[model samples]
Target: MMSSTFLVMRERVVAAIMSNPVVGPDSAGTLARMNDPSQNCTFEELGFDSLARMEFCIFLETEFGISLSSGEIEASPSINAMAAYLAGEG
Candidate 1:
């Protein structure tokens, strides 16, 4: 089972992804796939190229008030991994 904190973090991450112009409406299906806890969806798998990853990193820093280096983002590419990272940071 996932912790409530993790679940909340996951939702925030998904919201950030959805808010990206690059990931707008057309990526709805990819977003849906991301919501699945059973799957480990990486940035690449979700169609987030280099620029999208940078955007996502900026989103996380702005929304979560946490700094993440490109290396950190690369190290934790999946939403679940990012959520776990946030949990650890908290």
Candidate 2:
């Protein structure tokens, strides 16, 4: 089971992805898919190349006030895993 904190962070993480210009386009279809909780996709599945990953890391650092390496993000690739990892960090 996921903690409340994890669940909330998961939503925020999804929101972050949706807001990412490189990873997510401003398309309704993409937003709909992103909103679907069942669609827990890895960064690769979301078409994240090295540049996108680095940009997202910068975004995360700015948004969460926490520094994370690309390797760390790659390790916890999915939203759920990332959220859990972040919740633990908190």
Candidate 3:
């Protein structure tokens, strides 16, 4: 079962993605799909490229007050994956 903390983190990740100016408006549907726990879509499919991915990593770091290695960012490329990584389950 998924922990409540992880679930909340997932929601926060989705919210962050939605608020990102660079990739938000264009991928609103993808962001909405991220709310589904079963979804595991990649950033590329959601219209995010390397620069957008880096920007998102920066956003997550600032929002969570945590530093993320490039490997960590690459490893957690989806909303659920990112939530797991943030929750220390990655």
Query: Each prediction's TM-score against the native?
Result: 0.77, 0.78, 0.77
lDDT of 2 by residue, 1-90 (tens): 557887777787887787677877446766665666655667777888777878877887788776888898888987767887888943
lDDT of 3 by residue, 1-90 (tens): 999888888877776677666776345566557768766656656777667776777777788776776567678887788888888777
Q: What clash pairs does model 3 have?
A: none
TM-score, candidate number 2: 0.78
Who is ahead in lDDT, 1 or 2?
Answer: 2
TM-score of 3: 0.77
lDDT of every predicted structure (CA atoms): 0.73, 0.75, 0.73
When sorted by lDDT, best at the front, the candidate numbers are 2, 1, 3
Output the better candidate (1/2) by TM-score: 2
Runs of candidate 2 with Cα error greater than 4 angstroms are 25-33, 36-39
**Best prediction by lDDT:** 2
lDDT of 2 at 32: 66
Residue 52, model 2: Cα distance from true site in angstroms: 0.9
